[model samples]
Target: MTTNEFIQKLDGLFAAQEYGKVESFMLSALEEAKEKEDYGLYLSVGNEMIGYYRSISRFQKAYQISEDMLLLMEELQMDQSAEFATVLLNTATAYSFDENFEMALRFYRRAEQIYHLLVSPDDYLFAGLYNNMSSLMEKMDRNEEALDLLMKALAILKNYPDRQMEAATNFTNLGLLYLKTGDCNSGKKCVMQAIGMFEALDTPASHYSAALSALGEICYHEKDYEQAVIWYERTLEEIKKHYGFNLAYAVVCENLANVCREMERQGQAQEWLKRASEVRKRLEGENSGELHDIDNTAAVVNKEEKTVKTGGTKQKALERCREYYERYGKPILKQFPGLQGHFAAGLVGEGSECFGYDDSISADHDYFPRFYIWLDDEAYEKYGEELRAAYQKLPRHFEEFADTVMTPEAVSRCGVWKTTDFYHRLLGRQTPPETMYDWVSLQETRLATVTNGEVFEDCGGGFMAQREVYLSYFPEDVRRKKLAARLRKMAQMGQYQYARCMMRGEYVAAQMALAEFIQNTGSACFLLAGQYMPYFKWMHRKMKELSALSEVAGKLEKLALLPSQQDKWDEEKPERYRFALNTADEKVALIEEIAGRIAVELRRQGLAEGKDSYLEPYAAEVESRIEDPVLRMANLV
Candidate 1:
């Protein structure tokens, strides 16, 4: 076939989604190029194959093709040529996606050098290089560097005003980076600018939809629920107008639902939730992959943004862990060939990181891209050490990450481990606990940690499936019993004792009572939702995720920050003390009001029944509803 006809045929097959035919045609063209000794044609065909392989997740083949391009260039004695630089850049990209940052960076710098020395600037290549490098730096927890690189990319696009779509993308990246750094104002500004640019230009719906969705995220985090709704609505408008029902549309729909739920507007939330389901059906029809999860509540960063590198939240850590598995661990196991099905891979432990609660501050000691490979008995005895060696030899620096500091219990983490031993260490028994007593007695926080985080694969050994069952939570009676006790404590501290302490002029004791009340209410909310209370660090943060009484969380936070009477007592005499006392009294009333709201939720759930405003009566009513004979007969406290 003539070259033009061959190119047209290849394009037709690609447009028709006939991947098999496209691959077949490309292979024949590649063979012809090699036989004709046309290095440029050979490289062109190889690059197309590389893109095809990457689109299909055949990353190993993608990297291999890039390697062959370099080999052909070297054989032709073409060093320091623009063509060689293109191959080098392509190879660097393949390595970057594989999370081998050291090699990727080396090649990227080399390619950049050649581009500067031997080639005129290609606007597309210049903008893309900086963009991809910024992404890599972001994954390394080097936010400042990532931001700098993105700005550089934006600078490049600015020179080419027709590249408005590319500029919008750069703006979106900047917005997300600013948000990652806790600069919500700057994040919102950049994202809004991107939205404006995308709207002005004839860009794809995704460009503008992403920008609007990011604004929604910023407003949601700032607790500007009305503004969040507006931003999310704009995103929904864009998606429906252009893309119709797709994953992004579903995501914005669900994001709107979450904001409405948080604002105590359940009817609106429900409407949006149904829209989300419909969008999911459309997304599924396109085989776009599994449905994305619910956007994480403020207690965690948005799961949709997990790939953005900033702090080390447990969610981010899990995402990083998955990236590592797919890039390094999975490929290594594939080399084992015959033994692939004899193992499982995931993160399992009682650590805060395991619970997806680790942040950048907590990550200072031990937290990053790490996971366990659990092998079967036979696999453990034979190939365990070899697999461990392979893992050790895998790329140590992924993205911008530095060498990991192995902790004291090094062998138990981020390496080849036996599944039985892993479970025994985390849960005190092999596999998951099978009895009610085992579930009840074990610390719920530990259980949450053990069952949280992603299991990339179980290699058909049933490990992932059983973990799913363990995550379904304890028996209904146990949840009610726990909720009842927490409710009783909240009533005693907030509804009963706080006001009494204030009345007696025991100012310090009153503050302590307020603190305890907030704690009880926070824990009670988690129990009410049948969720395990996370560690104390995440208790108040996670409390806001409970749609039952999440509005109370804001009040609880204000109560925690209330000034003790002494601050005013020392500054002035009677008047200041009176002012402090009045503030304390109002806080106590607010706490009680929130307690009543919790009582309302309990009654709605049929877990409590009473007309009494005092929380103690409602607590008693809830205890009476516990169905388990043993738990129901147990003491209220």
Candidate 2:
């Protein structure tokens, strides 16, 4: 078939909404194009497939197809051509969706270079490029640069009367950007204009839904809960009609719940919350992979007799431990009367399950129905081995789930251990830190682990006393010193060095600076909340649980994951440096906003003296308040 005929057939299937059949049809077309040695037809079919997969949120497939297209383009020696540039733009978008921001920026830069060499200043292709590139810049927290490029796209799009949908979309984005930059009046005006355009054009439901949602967000921000509910309800209807129970539907439900709660409509708020939770649960369940039972009998019984089943309900490790203990541990301890009043039993240390954050994926290793039994040094010397032997003789299976096969090194995590030895292994000393230097040198994650989980029983009271000391959090002087150090790092890396690196076209260095800034900012937030930050892998998860700066976790995540504007920061083109500088300034403004929040918490806690949005002054103030001479004189990292 001719390429035109093939494309028409595909369009017909899409118009009919036969999405389930679309992938197979596209694959058949791609195979036919390949067999005929028709490279042009193959490219056309492949591009259509990539767009389809991306729309369906199958990002890995989209990315793989993009890679294949790029390889084909290279074999055809079409690197410098307009078609190659289009493919590069598509590939960059796929990379962005896959959260590979560095690679996304590299491809975007390559595409921009080719477009600069081949296209006119006012070409429609440049308008498309600017629109897509602006989105990446916005994701990267470069709001000012995003606004500029979006405006440029809107101006060029106005020259084409047939591109009203694209123009309206740009207006919607520009409004959101303006709101982000604190231009409330301009933001509302732009959004209203886009709403008018969308209504006039009778565009797809998603377009109108987005504009409604934007207005809903504005109303919610302005404390107009009633109006926010009205807008959000309208958006929810549109989303339900077009997209059903997808992520957008869940988000709108959450928005409505928040608005209802603010208006003190508890019943309505709970209804929305329940709906959102149900949608999210269903979505997560669909993606969690096939479930399997954990029967230890498979190891001993005949393989043919063991029935492997799918879709077993997985229990949290902590819950499983409690059940196992109730069924066997309490009875087993009764058999050893000498160990009765000398031990403390609980689950803690060295795993996500200890922090109550474990899921099914955690059961792959070092997970089982297990709990720690701590004994006083004398009690341990007298009966530790005997108690452990009794514990091991208990059943290996509970509720049809088997204990995980642990590595030799992990055996120490459970069973009987001398109380002193446990503290020594975790904190490197038998007692709590005595000096400010000692306190400051301990890893916050270690402190967090030692104090996490529940003490199911502590008849001896020794382990509980030591655990309570650690649970009291850091001394005031040591906390001040650590907070000061984190604040200094945030100021240096986020507010200062990140911008400097961008201006000098050190893209990789810019990324590193931003990463360090995020890390220190997160640590500072935990310190403000008077909570020890957990391990690096669980920091964001734990940050969400903090009462102070709870909202900051999402903002920090965005700053870390967003794609940088490498296209504008190209050192080879001196003309773009000014624009890159503006982008960097925009990011600095975001950093300052985060710093302002931190400063508010600091002032509230009497930890610093400052009305300044910059954190360096606050850092200095905090450091000066550290009364410990040694910590006060220590280097501020």
Candidate 3:
């Protein structure tokens, strides 16, 4: 086919979602490019397919394609080009997703090398590279180095104008760092500034949503449930209005339910709780015994009458877990005789019913006869295949269970593994080394917590030592970039346009700002999720498990429910809309406060020096430049 027709055909295939056809066509194109010695076309075709492979979870093929691209770049001696940088970044990210952090880091550094050569010192692109590097450092446990890099990105942004959001992001991250090190005041200031900027700029829903969510977390930690509930509510509204029944919203709602439950808002709390439960049921679809209700509440009983009955024991659950382990455990041990890792033989930690408290309700789900296999790095080196084979041989169907849920293969394979070895397989090392800056970003997220689950061994303490590594957190620079992007957009929408349009009765214009707000906030949440060790899709899945905050999922759904102008725009709809908006605003305020605290915390932790100014240095700088501090501070500029 002629080139244009071929291109048209390829586009058609892509539009049809015919992935295999797309791959085949692309491969043919690659071959043709090679024959023509058209290096640029070869690279382009190869790069596109590389992304396709990665998208389909074909990591090995993706890795192979990346290698081919790298070789082609080297042949052309364009290793320092943006094209090369792009490939490198793509390759590193792909590897990182596959848990091959070492190769990912190496390529990421190379991408940075090229990126630095082209971008200005203070540019967002440079900040992005620094951010990625800092994340890698956190994964590696080089906290000090990560901190230094984050500061460098912050310093660069400080000197650059029109970098309000970026600076705010840096401030927020700095706040996270402080929180990590137990420096609450500084962290609060930084996070507050970030929230302010996002609100002012009319950021996407998730940006404000994340900020508010963090604020709720801070409040929870401070034992301030009222404030936490308010922020959580706001976060819930934003996520509901934007993401539309997505997992992130569900999780946030679940979290909000927790805040409500803690604050004695049982009526409101139950609403959220019910939503969370429904979402989980939907997500579980066909029930899997491995599904754990991490934040689920127990059956309610009269507080004064049956406190003992209401408060379930962990021991009962343990017995069930042990029973399953015994039934299936022996066979796994026999299959992998070469195992010598930390948890080579049996179950421990969460599934270790012998060492656990029994909670009968826990057996409703996630409780099963399963155990994790532990191994040291050396045993994996010698007997990885045997271990894999043995683990895969375990029965998929378990008979004689109250809930005959299918056990996920991932968890079933768990009994034959060690925590450190697993991490090494997935994260390129046993642990991730995050900088103080990374910690700042991470404190706003759950990636670290998820990755930190159920460590099965500490043989020689090597695995435990690496716990400091792979501490899935965001880098300061990336946070800054995203924050800056939000600020710039928010300014174009919320502060500058929304109220004026509303006053003018220009509902469409007002709605546009709302749209802008939704987009920015949604992206922000994704950004927060991205910094951690979990894959993006998985993060969304886990978020939905939070049954308490499912209202956010409602809000996300509502965003797409646009009203027609021919009919007087539903006045009732606006009230419902305002509910979401008000909630989002509250969330924004909470997040901003959290960001401020983050700043204070970081400074106290010594990751950053005191700026001797207001809540945020960058905000103060902008405020100082504004002709009217009141108008500027009020977000009227």
Find the candidate with the highest TM-score and give its number.
2
Give the per-residue lDDT of model 3 (tens digit) for 27-102.
8998998899877777777777766665444565775676667656655777679888878777776666455555
For model 1, what is the C-alpha lDDT against the true structure?
0.68
Which is the better candidate, 1 or 2, if ranked by lDDT?
A: 2
Candidate 1 lDDT tens digits, 209-241: 778888889999999999998888877766545
Better of 1 and 3 by TM-score: 1
What CA RMSD would candidate 3 show?
Answer: 26.3
Worst 10 residues of 1 by lDDT: 297-306
Between prediction 2 and prediction 3, the one with superior TM-score is 2
Compared with the true structure, all predictions reach lDDT values of 0.68, 0.75, 0.53
- Per-prediction TM-score, please? 0.48, 0.50, 0.39
When sorted by lDDT, best at the front, the candidate numbers are: 2, 1, 3
For model 2 the local lDDT of residue 46 reads 82
| lDDT of candidate 2 over 1-637, digit per residue (tens) | 7799888887676556555577898899889998998888888888887766654445556755766676577667786888888877886776564444444665688788898899787888888888877877887677888988998998899899888777877888888888888887788888888888888874353567878898898888889988998899888777655444555667887898798778877666656655665565554454353212112211322222233332344556776787677777777777767876788888878888889888767767777678878888878888878888988887766673555767875787787888888989988888777777778878888999998887777778278878877776788788889999999999999877887787787889998999899889889988876778998989998887664576688888766666666654454345654353344444665787888878866754446656577789999899898887777888733
User: Top model by lDDT, which number?
Assistant: 2
Give the TM-score ranking, best first. Answer: 2, 1, 3
